[model samples]
Target: MAAAATSTSTTQLSAPYRRSSTLQNSNYNKNNNSNKVPSNGVNGDRQVMVSKRGCNGVDNGGGFCWKASFMYWTLEDVAHVARHHWILCLFAVGLLFFMAVEYTLRMVPASSPPFDLGFVATRCLHRLLESWPELNTLLAALNTVFVGMQTTYIVWAWLIEGRPRATISALFMFTCRGILGYSTQLPLPQGFLGSGADFPVGNVSFFLFFSGHVAGSVIASLDMRRMQRWEMAWLFDVLNVFQAIRLLGTRGHYTIDLAVGFGAGYLFDSLAGKYEESKRRTSLLLHKEASLT
Candidate 1:
């Protein structure tokens, strides 16, 4: 009797473990099954299913299915994702664009001198506003603030929000501005006179046709808009207008320059928004399909 009771207890203990092993195998099989689909799975069914192994390996789908939360994507997550192929490509493009812009600024002179509307507008604005010393000081202060805000926003977008689009947009604007700047090679307005501090680089005798400040402002503004920060968008828009006026008032740029800058920046912003939205939608669809499967 004693031996039989002992044997029964051992079997009872082993029974639970046996059941546990079977449950684990069942789960494993289910996961494996998810990677397979019925013959009609690929047909035009209203509902679709996705498999993790199939999506990540069997197909050439990119690694963008991972869910992202704005509050959770810390700098570390950004660094991790920055190593992705697409991000790497963006970085390469941004670097090349930056170098091109810098080279253009340093080497190219305007192919033709400024004439017509740009020169006339600059001449008039300089004559009217160049004499106001206090106004110049205030404009300088505003420009400084604008630069500070733009830099901060870029850092936040790229690092905190994990947005590579911001970097690309900035590089694009710089390249466009540089190309225009070198192409126009227009001289400063005839009455262009301001505090000597305005041209710290001492090349104030010329360099016109497009305003980098206004372009930078516009890019920053549009980036803020994409982030869905209405307050920031409004603030940057107002600052951009002020920056454009400052460029004209200080004889730093012509009206045409501001207009071109605005156009180019706005165009880039639209393109970036579309690209980002498409990527987001693709990722969500894949995730949902995978979950359903």
Candidate 2:
């Protein structure tokens, strides 16, 4: 009975110590859990925070941190876009302004004098030419000489230099020009200065939709550039500009015609290049097949 009592007392005394240890262990586990960052919660939500030094030495979380406020994020994105595409932004503003201008623009009356900015700018020159028919003829003669030069360069590139690209481009451009020109024949402009020495001499009928003169010059200039003849190319470009101005002053071609001529020259050159490349690829394929056989 004494031993049984002693054992019972020992059990009662150890029970409080065990309970205190259990409580301490539970508190420690709770503290550890509270200190730990949650990778995932019961609802599968994950939250993370990382500190990193920013450009200004302040903690910015990280380089691509998403913890920033909405307004700040939006402003950062806007600044990034603006820095890279400022020109695009400028054009966008221009687009809006032009839209407003177009909306407010008045329609021109049919009876109103044909208003052309180029014509107005060259009014004095035009008057001088009108007064001196001989001077106009002389200018036409000089322009013809320039045309001859362009023709010589193009032909020489094909026949002498063994480069057919310019020739092919010229042929393609002229053929397309002929088709387009005949399809819609614009009436001759008023106050046109005719010259006996001009191409299609004696005021013969010609297409007015696009200027072949400008197109031909562009073709020659492009070929010169390809040949690395910088001096010749520059000369062609300057003469081409003068030719365009003279054409405009003489009422030889409309503004749209000259612009389209420039485009056509570039377009035809590209097409010709593509054609040559295709031909070369075909030849290579045929040779390879023959060798394999």
Candidate 3:
């Protein structure tokens, strides 16, 4: 009975020891868990996101940190933070220039001396007018497609790429060409398209110095090529040639006008490319400086 009582007393003493050890072990585990960092995926997300995210002004030496808040911003918000005001300004200026050119076109005298080359080409092409119905339909279709492509390029460059130089260059060239077209005050050819169906805007007698269609096509083609849209570029290039021929056949533009238009398009495209390159370099330099400091 004495041995049995001693064994019970030992068992009671060991139970307290076990409880104390269990408490110590739980405390140790809590400390270990507290020291350990969470492995949730925020670090990986940071590596994938743009450094500009959550940046209010230019980044001033803060290493890339992805913020969920910045990632959720809309395109307009991003563009605003990027300071894309020049795009809006260029568009506004282009609109003003268009209005000015249209006014000049309206004011120019209807009777102007026609270039001999244009006269000769128009006379010859006019003789081939076998079917007005077919010719008109074809011309209308081409015009519609050309206008659509030009509009798409303008929107893509400005809205998607946040670049307005292409649109600006096109607008500036178009205005300048229009001024030149009206300055000559070229006389309308005898077989000139007169009806509203033939000339969507008005008489083709005024803006005949260079084929706007050809110039626009060349600009759109070059811009498309620059944008890395190879198929679109080639399509516009083909359309350019086709439009040139159509202008000649319809007596809408003289040969000299077409030649000048082609040259102008190339020249302006080069200018726009240079402008865009400079802007890109500047942006890169600024971004680098911002990152370093």
Best by lDDT: 2
Candidate 3 residue spans exceeding 4 A from truth: 1-125, 194-199, 202-206, 278-293
lDDT of 2 by residue, 105-158 (tens): 887687665556777777888999999999899999999999999899999999
lDDT of 3 by residue, 1-293 (tens): 99988555443312323334445447745764676534456643432232224322222344353223443445544454345455666788899999998888645344655444554655655565434646655575666677677778876887898878668778778888878877776656555543344434444345777766677778877777777889988888877777676667666667888899899888887887788799889999999999999
TM-score versus the correct structure, for each prediction: 0.49, 0.70, 0.51
Which pairs of residues have clashing backbones in candidate 2?
Answer: none
Q: After superposition, how far is residue 258 of candidate 3 from its true place, in Å?
A: 0.7
Worst 10 residues of 1 by lDDT: 44-53
Candidate order (lDDT): 2, 3, 1
What is the lDDT of every predicted structure here?
0.63, 0.78, 0.65
RMSD of 2: 21.1
Top of the candidates by TM-score: 2
lDDT of 2 at 186: 73
- Deviation in Å, model 3, residue 82 alpha carbon: 54
RMSD of each: 22.0, 21.1, 26.1
Badly placed stretches (over 4 Å) of model 2 are 1-86, 109-114
Q: Which model, 1 or 2, shows the larger lDDT?
A: 2
